[model samples]
Target: MTSLVDLLHHPLRWRITQLLIGRSLTTRELAELLPDVATTTLYRQVGVLVKAGVLMVSDEHQVRGAVERTYTLNAQAGDADNAEVDHDKLRTMFTVFVAGIGGHLDQYLTRATIDPLADGISFRQTALNLSDEEFTEFITAYGELLARYADKPDTADRTRRMLSTLIVPD
Candidate 1:
């Protein structure tokens, strides 16, 4: 857990992790997605995460004149229940990270050739009630669904196809 915290301490590293959460992206692709960051700096941070076991090289291929390595997060690197850490701080960081990405995407789409509204892009919030057992079941089922499509070539495209689910206790 300490290692996870250490790895996530850097804002850029946390942004990288957030971007790669459920997708595999090559360094070049990540650089393009995160335009504010320098390519070399992003690559170095990715390498550190890879060496630290928080990320693994999911694919490697020679493209043009160089090798492009895609990475995925490693699930075994952190404990889900670390008692000593402040959960609120972690949650706040993640919330900010997510908001930043959303803001960037919105700005990019507005300036680029794409029309997000016409494309049906949206973000939403909802409330739900469930027993602890029901919540656990929902999480397990969702994990299975994510795993089932984890390796599909079109998985990334599917991810962009409109969806965000957040479950909060009420």
Candidate 2:
């Protein structure tokens, strides 16, 4: 089994995590969503994530003499306290995380038709002044708000959006 950092640091694997952020999906569904990636490579990355315990096989069933597994992000996958990651590894992971966001933006911009306003796309950075305890409270409240909508099912009136957050102390 690979360490979580080693398994999720790759661009493709990070993207796989992004795709599974709030939903359960099979390898076939992932391949269809990422048509540009070779099916073999995608499956390999998924296997790595599964082995690392970042992804859990939530469901499995037989299909045409083969087993199809539905994978969901592990509940504790993002809990950094569980792992003893070194400073260098943490820095590298942060860099990869930001790069993944940039890559997604690049892909969105390359699309033939895009209307930022209509699509409700926005990105902005702001400085916040808060005490340590207040900051913790803020994060907890923010996470609770996100949890309310994170697991929503797909519907005709809903559009999937990526939300990324980064904090840097000054």
CA lDDT of every candidate: 0.74, 0.87
Task: Report lDDT (Cα) of residue 136, candidate 1.
Answer: 90
Best by lDDT: 2
TM-score of 1: 0.66
Best model per TM-score: 2
Using Cα atoms with residue i matched to residue i, what is each candidate's TM-score against the true structure?
A: 0.66, 0.90
lDDT of 2 by residue, 34-148 (tens): 8899998999989988887889999999999999999999988757644677898888788888888887888789889999999888989999999999999999999999989
Query: Ten-residue segment with the worst summed lDDT in candidate 1?
Result: 155-164
How many residue pairs collide in each prediction?
Answer: 0, 0
- Distance from true location, Cα of 47 in model 1, Å: 2.3
Once fitted onto the true fold, the runs of candidate 1 whose alpha carbons sit more than 4 angstroms away are 1-3, 60-68, 80-83, 100-108, 111-117, 144-151, 155-163
